[model samples]
Target: MSRASPRYDRRVRLYDTYTRGLVELPPPPGPIGMYFCGPTVYQRIHVGNAIPFVLPLWLKRWLELDGYQTKLVINITDINDKIYDAAPGASAKLSTDATAWYIEDTGLLGLGRPDVEPTAVETVPDQIRTISALVDAGHAYESDGDVYYRVGSFPEYGRLSGQNPDQVEEQEPNARKEDPRDFALWKANKPTEDTWWDSPWGRGRPGWHIECSVMAEKHLGPEFEIHGGGLDLVFPHHENELAQSRALGHGFAHIWTHNGLLRFGGEKMSKSVGNVVSLREALDRWGREALLVFFLSGHWRKPLDYTDETMAAARAQWTDFVASVYDPSEERPARGWEALAEALEDDFNTPEALAILHEWRAAGQLELMKRGLSVFGLEIERVEPPAEVNVFKEARDAARAERNFEAADDNRARIEEHGWTVRDRPDGSVLVPKP
Candidate 1:
């Protein structure tokens, strides 16, 4: 695709976790393929989980705006130990219901759905094939009924997470494994479990790490543009995926992007930790624009704390922006939009982009402000005041002109009762909806 903006004209640099630095993405011959690690459908996804989900939407929108067709794949992890534990006798039913709820909740954020959403249950055959290839290549082994990836066999195992292989702790300790750090490619089905799939080894389910690897390969092919998830997945999950895919002789993902975790009270918000805030609850308390503005206030790569003060501040910021909307026909400078685009081009620097937006709004560049806000997926609707509101406003204006200060104040209070705010200007007053 042709580059539509100078911001994406082969000059933008995105940070890759593999390289540990900013690297330029080569112009793709076709659509850019992006794979994001999605939810494990054991329960409702919290706000922290939405960061990875929403960040990719921003990237996809920016890329498409710059004339690049993007294919985004987000996998639903339906087969996992957590799902079984959460539902006990009805794991499959739980996953199916949770997956549907996930779609509904994220849709509330107003970001469009991904191009492809493959489930682990549907892609079991592909996963079994990948595991078989790994075993044949001697990168994995089958013990009893479980298949484990031999960590020692992959020489470059620690490059992605920068952990010394010898020093890395074993995630799932199994006495039957050759090495302590060896991870499962497939787990043997337990007699107590209800969900099971037929594989070469036995009736079992795919591991968490292997699910993403197989799903990405099946949908986006072996090579893709970007692989993204939360920073928490960097160590064990992504590190294992890197080893397993590369050992199978495929260039998995060119750029590995990770968003910082959302925190509450200076600690990572986790359901297990009993500190999670549901995405629905947050969106209900605060509007979608305010929630998005809160996310945009900080850098995507930096951890952001969610607190009442921070949320209130974001609400105020959004209200202020909405209040500033004026005549779209008014002429404004274009420099602000250019500055915002430049910031976004630099590894999606949202904080810098937001600062430029504020500067434009303060400078009375309402048209430019509206355009800039739209680029970040914000829209400012121009609402017309009701006739009764105009009547009160005109009464206030007349009272002030006649030097009736008490009457003017009373009329202003009456307008406020109608859920409108009066912003006095040198020439006249502007009526804005109450924030």
Candidate 2:
């Protein structure tokens, strides 16, 4: 294994499921390939679903800052049982619409789209080829028009999941499977399903786990730097992907990083549970900066609970941070910036990095504050209000001074309508552009 670059040696330590420990990502000779599991586009994505999606974007930013070219791939699972069940005859349209919404909603968070986004429907041939290879190698079996991976053929079937093969329970029980633990590589066409693709096995669709393996390998090659998803997928979903890929004599992924799921009302926020807070809804109410603050408040590897009070706190903190951006200070404070970078380097510890930003702001180190925010992808540009804004502020303040409370309130409302906010200070009220 290559050692991490000197610039990122202390940072970029990630947990690897295959090794069952923290591993350093070595400096890449070429662009680093990162594949993160994306949404199965049956409907709108919620904040819970956004957690894992946002993680890779954040990692990509950090990697770029550390001087590594990164090629990020987040696949769209257009072909799935859920898509058919949700939209019936309109499955393809539903997937396309949901994918567009996913792009728009995540764009509001200020993280741009991934470099590559391959759809399962577009990669059917790749999936078929992989399944055919596994079968030719005796690692999988075809029975009753359905293709199932032979769990007994791969010795490390349960290694990623930390489950003994004997103790693992069977999922999607099929009578034709040679072993009960075997999982489907291709599901036989069903009368109730809406979409079908012709494959060597039969006219059917790719399995949920198999789509990701094929898509990731097709875009990033057999071996890649990182494969990431939610902690919930550590079971059969990711475990199956690992088995089939290894059986094909491929390296698959160097590290398997899973983020903790988001929760609401003490339950995992999911579409099935009907406890989801959609990304659009959250962004509409709290705005992007506040929502991002809420997300970064907790560690990425631990579960985050969504509550009104928590969101309110994040809003307040974001407001204060933005206010501090307008604070005038001349000092650069090199030590504070070094501390911020060090905190980020230590496994992307964002909370600690945020604390350092707070410290810099308290000390009136505007340069350091800017540096910190830039690293966190929270940088805000300073926009000076036009002459008309200053005139309105003067009129509003004069009305307040004259004890014309009614006039003052009206002036304040007009100022806000003009797309600026009035912040009252001991000396006077300051006008800032609405965030």
Task: Name the best candidate (by TM-score).
Answer: 1
Top lDDT model: 1
Model 1 TM-score, all chains together: 0.94
Backbone atom clashes (below 3 Å) for every candidate: 0, 1
* Model 1 pairs in collision: none
Q: Could you give candidate 2's per-residue lDDT for residues 116-212 as a string of tens digits?
A: 9899988999899999999999988888778999999888788898889777779899689888999999998988887798888778888999999
Model 1 misplacement above 4 A: 1-10, 28-30, 327-336
Candidate 2 wrong stretches, greater than 4 Å:
1-11, 28-30, 328-334, 386-389, 395-429, 433-435
lDDT of 2 at 276: 78
Each prediction's TM-score against the native?
0.94, 0.90
Per-candidate Cα lDDT values, in order, are 0.86, 0.83
